[model samples]
Target: MARLDRGSVSGAACGPDMPAIEVRSLSFAYPGADAAVLEGLDWSVPQGAFELLVGGTGSGKSTLLSLLKPEIAPAGERTGDARVLGENVADMDVRASAERVGYVFQDPENQIVCETVWHEMAFGLENLGVSRDEMRRRVAETSYFFGLEDWLHRDTDTLSGGRKQLLSLAAVLALRPRVLLLDEPTSQLDPVAEKNFLHALFRVNRELGCTVVVATHQPRPMLEYATRAYRIEGGCICKVADIASLGHREELFSGEVSGWGASRRAKNGVFSSASGQLDSLGPRGGAPGAKKGLKSGKSAEFEVQILSQDDSGVPSRVGGGRILQKMHGGSATTLSEGWFRYDRAAGWVLRGLDVTFSAGAVHAIVGGNGCGKSTMLSVLAKTAKLQRGRMVRGAASAALLPQNPKALLVAETVRGELMEWASTCGYDEDAAQERAAQLGLDGLDARHPYDLSGGQRQLLALAKLLLIGPELLLLDEPTKGLDLANRRIIARALCEHAQAGGTVIMATHDLDFAEQVADDIAMMFDGEIACMEPPTDFFADNVFYRA
Candidate 1:
């Protein structure tokens, strides 16, 4: 194990005492890449400074963080010196670096190791040989700091995306590192949770005196709390003297039409269900109360029977009523009396609830994270069956895109990966190549999937699903790691598919995305379908989404 000599750095050169972090001409590439993702980059974080790293997709922000922790570099791509605590990182072993600098990865699943929330929080300390009593004190302190004490005994897997992130942060805090490096920590969190998280992070930096560095596409919240901001583009970083100069910056990020008739900053708002006279609009005019959707043309009995089909497309239950009476003429799939239970949970994630999803619809499932949006999607995708309930008149074919796109990508080369999925979807060789080219993945097929950027990996996942040619597509937080451009591309793709008679159901916290791609929206509140309707009405009068 390599160790740093205390005398190597003279007086006031160690972290907290000196700079918390320092990098000099750091460049890194993956094993097979020709160009370094981070090329001759130099950066430093002064003690107690709260800084933000802003960049577009594939701009090397993540790669730089990886270099700071020395985790994601390919075996041979790292060069130059990186110092954490004024000690050269390359000379320090992985364990020492982890202990010195706390890193929260862009993906929460990548860092989650324990089953229960308490166990996950205790993991880091236990690994470092902290005693049980010490671990308990630290876990309680960190949990209380992040407002996670209520759920301390909850199963970690059952938490919502935002809650899971909080747990991840709590785990890192328990280790008590002097520096915290966060990569888009708010990406998966809902607006409320995201807001709370930012405040907590501020407290940690201000009250605890920890150096903070975060990489994000949306920079508003960061700018609000950040003392310094650096913009990274084309592998270069430049300091922004005035963050306000980014100007009407929120509008640019969210791209949503606000009441001000201007694009709202996409990052700050939340989607909510409304119950006024919204439906009075009749799906055309501006109504203030009651959400609108296709009315049941037939009796409830008939609708339930047709929706209760088994895996082989046969209805397991029969009901008395006119078969086509409930057919509202639009594509709607529903699960009646749906219920799902996990191993460690005392209650079901979904409990005997009736939910409906229509084709060409853009629905936003809004509940505190862990409200069962993912579980509901699983039933819709047929990946997991509900402990109870029957689905009726579902799409002819469906494709599911999981939150962790990385796991779905298994091919050695990007092109080969696309081809593999295409073949699985019953496409011919020539057709797969054509589809790959159409998806803007023509030349890079030969490149390894693992070597692609975060955005590229997500696009690849979509391409794989599209190759299957399903009539209905389910995407879970598809925009989590994407920038505006790639996110728009994805939205366009989903829209085009819907236009061509395909259906889409996306579960996301991106209110901007909900406004852009959804024809209709559904807000799931506490495992119950609180309200479902068009996007216009969904946002209308909803205080949570106002600019």
Candidate 2:
């Protein structure tokens, strides 16, 4: 159904007993931009609606959410009025609105302000002047609920990405806001951790009736729970009467609700199944085999290894455990070796390890929350040394795209930056520009690195590394903050690069993304590789193979 226009909505009139949030004709545009992000958008949530907003990236879902809490709205935008809890957002003060609205940013790093989990959780209550004793109680309560009591004192930097996101939530929940806005809160989490977080969210909604609104490209987890599902397009919102009727049942499991060949309506009498769509749900596809023969099972795989760079700058004397696996190609990759711990207090975090990645293939790693997937990726990237057994390999060129690519960008113009990296790679300016265009950065030569969105920044960072032509690329949770169009733009570029015979390794919670683009699949649990196989087999049956 098409959505209403902003001019059609009114602020002075919501019927009595209206939902916690009501938007009518809420239109807005970003600063210095003539185009409006939202036009004639209208949506309303009763006192306790669990609303789920689903759309591709840059579809104006985030922009709509920002309107609910005006403090976060971008500057230089004209907005039709939106009322939250009987108060017009434009008229309300920012701080007071913050206290009443709990918003969790998509990037945990952006929202995290404290050094430790305990302090971070308590910061909100402290600002509200909740007594010290009360703050302590709230902290303890939230920690216990989110399973963070043991790591309460742990440094925020030391926490894994999933854990860091969990901490972000606990901190926001500590504020006990009347309305909760989660912006892709589960993008970094593994399966288990995501389930736990959702359980907590539902509990809060059920018990406290804290009106919940979440914007996400992935909707399976919230399918049965969300009171209403709304789709955003052209900066407008429309009520979706029945999501099941959309004919994308697979979306209820994997988030591949949108994609090429994926959005095909149930037409032409074609039947679909797990392996791939078919005329009939039969075994003809045989669940496409993995690149490295890793099988599937319910439990995750775990392997471990440790090695050090010798005096000759070569990987020498691998001594950790059995985490190393040599694929058909010459390259060797690391899988988790059961959960490893540096101290007794840290306990075991990784479990069974099994992952098989071909040297020249594009593989994606994903799992539920707190599943030690990022830790394994860090090990692969050689960023976090393992105390038990770090996966060590012979000298191989590797480039990693951290969750935030902005951290690595340090150039004035895209052209200058690529030129700098080209010099390092012994390439000339013309060569660098050629590579930049291939990556889809046309006419962006003079653009400041900081001006790019998360996706564009990532592409630029990748361009810099590609100039050197690294043999292996390790991308840690690359699509966390990207919109669908941006995500597709990056994915297509990576696919082209892979076709050119480079090995691409991506760790993400986007399962559908893996299914669509990965040549091989790896699933991590605890600190081990649970399964590694082809996308088809991994999703249908979780299994990892050993070489």
Candidate 3:
């Protein structure tokens, strides 16, 4: 939260109809790059409009967002005129620009600097030299509006991922910036939390008149609230249109089908709600061998069944071999009455959790934030000791990828990092390169690992772990900042791993992804696993846990 010290530019008076942001013939490249990441890009955001920026991984969405602020503008050759609130961003003072243009990073932890929630909210105002009374008043108002009153006195480290992200937004909003720039703010949140956070952003735009520009891979949830939408490709703006004219609003809710007896049809592997009779006896319907009119015990609710077929109307086996082959005979890890906690004074994170992971299978753990999903993964990965439970390990070794992928990144270049892991695992350079290409890191071998985008960094970390050839792979939020295309790549890779007799256990808030790849879905709640069943049964039966 240290204030940047670049010199300031005098504020320019803007008319009511002027755009909040305007860019013309902007081109930028990093210090050592051969070509510009953004080339001849021109864009504008209408005043008070909620703008959504959608693009694939490494598509310059982040680069464009960075150029909007003076303090964080990338170091490189630049040619263009970028203006914010009628003032040229290149000439604006750091402090003044920050006051009118608030930026929130993808990772909430990165933006937070103070220990407690209250202090974090006050940090930005303090940097702006606001009076003590005024700071207190603004902090109180912002916190209350964001619903942080209950946790105001609590330590920030103790809050859940969702709360931490909300706290970051509240802190930025306390400055009362005229425009807010968010980079994948909801990528780490659960479905419910993500929805709530987007609604809060809508309120900020509608009620406070703060123009918003969000760059996200998951744009379906925010489309309804967006006034305009733009798609970036090949370092340029490819499509721009009003949100209402997008003609695919219903498709946005395709992945969120939760109510009992509710049936949904899958389109190109994405799920959406169905209002008519459920199809239970066809290739596009329920489980094979299931009755035509399957219903739940209490009511006529149809049993949740995911149709297994590719887009071409043909049965397709996603995994190499038979699905769920390991569930019958293979067991990688078993936790019996497992219980864990950080300290004796703190409440237990995992309470009597009993679950078994099968080899040659992908298991997904889904739950609300702070419900012990990560803690369970740590226990299974042997990073955390099981205090009061019997544990059985079936695998010889396991590789744990923490939620923050940056933790495992230390090498100067991406290739060096992978090669280091390869050397440890007795792998050759060819094998390393092959794996890197599979994960879409083919041409980034010589680039600095820190310089890659967040999604790229996540993929590199995964590639490093894959080179080790561990018996068990543990991933936490593998798809946090990845676009849909990148997510598909990871999903296919995990499926191939399972086919090769390896165990894969991932804890994610992405329920759509869980349905797409998981053989078994486990729900954790109140420090204990509440249920474990097939993807179809797990999502259809549980109302709240269904994403």
Using TM-score as the measure, the top candidate is 3
Model 1 over residues 431-458: C-alpha lDDT tens digits? 5565455445665766787666666778
Model 1 accuracy (lDDT, Cα): 0.68
Q: Which candidate would rank higher by lDDT, 1 or 3?
A: 3
**Sort by lDDT, best first: what order?**
3, 1, 2
Model 2 lDDT-worst window of ten: 298-307
Off by over 4 Å in 3: 1-10, 242-329, 544-547
List residue ranges in candidate 2 displaced over 4 A.
1-16, 245-330, 333-357, 368-371, 386-396, 410-468, 482-491, 543-547
What's the lDDT for residue 477 in model 1? 87
Q: Provide the lDDT at 281 for model 3.
A: 37
Scored against the true structure, residue 6 in model 1 reaches a CA lDDT of 36
Please state the error at residue 2 of candidate 3 in Å: 27
Candidate 2 lDDT over residue span 84-192, tens digit each = 8777888767455755678887767877888988889988788767899988988887788788977889878767778888898889877777778988888787666
lDDT for predicted candidate 2 compared with the true structure: 0.63
What's model 3's lDDT at 500? 45
> How many residue pairs clash (N, CA or C atoms closer than 3 angstroms) in each of the candidate models, in the order given?
19, 43, 2
lDDT of each: 0.68, 0.63, 0.75
Which should have the higher TM-score, number 2 or number 3? 3
TM-score of 2: 0.72
Superposed by TM-score, candidate 2 places the C-alpha of residue 271 at a distance from the truth, in angstroms, of 25
